[model samples]
Target: MVSQENGNQSQQTGGRFAVTLPLATLRGVGVQLGGRDILTDVTAQLRRREVTALIGLNGAGKTTLLRALLGEIPYSGEIRFDCVHGNRQQPGHIGYVPQRLRIEGNLPLTVFDLCGLSLRRWPWFLPLGTRFRERVYAMLDAVSVAHLLDTEIRVLSGGELQRVLLALALEPTPELLLLDEPAAGIDFHMQEEFYGLIGRLNRERGVTVLLVSHDLTMVSKSVGHVWCLKDGQIECEGSPHDLLHGDALARIFGSHQGVFGHRH
Candidate 1:
């Protein structure tokens, strides 16, 4: 629950949190790694309940910025959260899904095991309670993954795995969600479903979402604001339609020419 008067003009919520300030404000955020500047002057305000997109070419510091916000990396910046999270650690108040998760294919981990472990604080030697298992199943049902409760994590398809991760994130719904390229391996159809699910959460549940994605068309269609990063600096910040036009697309992503208007 940290409040700062500085942010984009009128980046306030019109819903339940309207009386409160913006959900978050980042100002003069800079990061350096291995003697190289990863980000400089990266500032953005995330208004409550709006789905925002973070777009950039490879190595454009999108992940680095997310890491900075999560307090996973040491960086020079000021990241202030609204009063809802000011009293606690920011990481505990936010949910995150990375670009990809790597696990051994042969591991016998089940979906139930994964979710239960997160909610449980007891030693690994202790068995999980039945009541917790039921709760995990209920969350899985929300993401249409209840049928895969006993299935091995590695055995699930790409889209299924992503949804499972999403289900896990929504259980104790946080004030904000950080999704890093959540639709990486999913096909066209699955991607649509994934985007729709995110939209529903934001609109109905009032969760603020910021996702890193390369699907320009999907960003344009689903997100209210888009932040384009280049060389560790914010190259452009505006509505999806304004920043994702023809020449801007070509300038940022040369090989994916004319892809701004097409769906991935």
Candidate 2:
């Protein structure tokens, strides 16, 4: 675990991913779409500087919950973000990495252009200023994508693109980070590296993370806490060791022996 509070360090929260308190709280979260109930009374707390995984089978409303937290969808519940350290105002107070990024591969935009595209003040037609380009390069370097700075967006493979997206999400390092199926398209080795990077960020930078993934094996090993969502509601929650056995994980997928198989 990273250092939590050590005198003056606990008060500092800039240029780093330090979150020294419960950063997000959810209560009675419910969502309905097209008159069909998608989520019901979901409640959970995102601990500071810890990786928490949300696990469930496909169509279990995991993505819906993430969307609710992102404020992309309307929900009938309370989602609160507490002010961390001293000042809460800054660039990228919240960062998110979605499951898939759809971009035109043939677009001549280089990785450097993509990194600074969103942060640039002017429209896409304007040239990226020097300061902005340098900042983008720094962000890419954080995720080890600096070498691909001039590579076109379309040329990036599955793993490379994910790294770029992660670097973008962490530009300036947000206090709260959300990831949805971040390793969906990568192989096992790439997934390991990807998650390893996330763990390092959590431990070293103290960024609070909420991860939605189906990789039970990796999630079980990486996250400090597990929230099992089933049929749109959180069925159970605890440490990975506590919830990975018997019916705890089984029920999360609405199956007895199919999802986890003999692993459980």
Candidate 3:
């Protein structure tokens, strides 16, 4: 991976690493879909309790990397986890909030029904006990959306749905949280609120986050470390200031000046 060694870049001051230990490491990770390589020899580390952002142009394998970590797709390489509990071949507890949830055509499921179904494995008709409701309430309350518990999922706006999804992902307090374009389709204000919540989670709960987003401006301000994926590989990795404000993004993105925002 390329390193940003530029001297003029501002150093990240927010304890860029509370713990330098790596929570997870990916070495020579590669993924192929439909006989086409989606990721190639991607090597990177997710530091313990640090928020890392993955940024790249469309089809840059950002989401593929996240999916590979989730083990939803087969890949060629070693994904090793060395959490505080113990070393493991797979992740312990992973919370994933996808870019969007696609409900079946015109399905009329309330926020309660959606969260309740995921919280338990039984049929949808099965009675959700008071304890279950209380648990869900606490989860929603964390994201400040408990009042929308009974609202129809279909009726929710983009921001509301994303918040609801975030609440669901925080359950059981996962060790690693994977968010894909979490702020996409939401207003700027909502995006700011969402990112603030994520930062709080990292600081308070020590939940290691690996997020994939196209919003370079937000990623620059919200994350500690930023990974630039170009042509299916990690082109560079460093603090947001080092990567975003330095020449790293220019080299990784090439002529995509408007996207990087570092060039006038």
**Best candidate, TM-score:** 3
Relative to the true structure, candidate 2 reaches a TM of 0.84
Ranking the candidates on lDDT from highest down gives 3, 1, 2
Q: Can you write out model 1's per-residue Cα lDDT over 146-169, one digit (the tens) per residue?
A: 999999998999899999998887
Off by over 4 Å in 2: 1-21, 85-91, 256-264
lDDT of 3 at 57: 82
Show model 3 residue runs off by greater than 4 Å: 4-18, 84-92, 121-125, 260-264
- Whole-model lDDT values for every prediction: 0.79, 0.76, 0.82
Error of 2 at 154 (Å): 1.5
Cα lDDT tens digits, model 2, 1-264, are: 111222223433564434554566677899998899989888776677789998777677877888887778899978776645323323457788887678875679888877767666677887777887788878888888889989998888888988988998887688878898888778899999889999999999878789987777888888998888876777777888888776665545545456632121
Tens-place lDDT per residue, model 3, 121-230, is 67777799999899898899999999999999999998999999999888878888999989888888999999999999999998999998878889888999988888
Instruction: Go through the candidates in order and give the C-alpha RMSD of each one to the true structure.
Output: 4.4, 5.7, 5.8
| Cand. 2 Cα-lDDT | 0.76
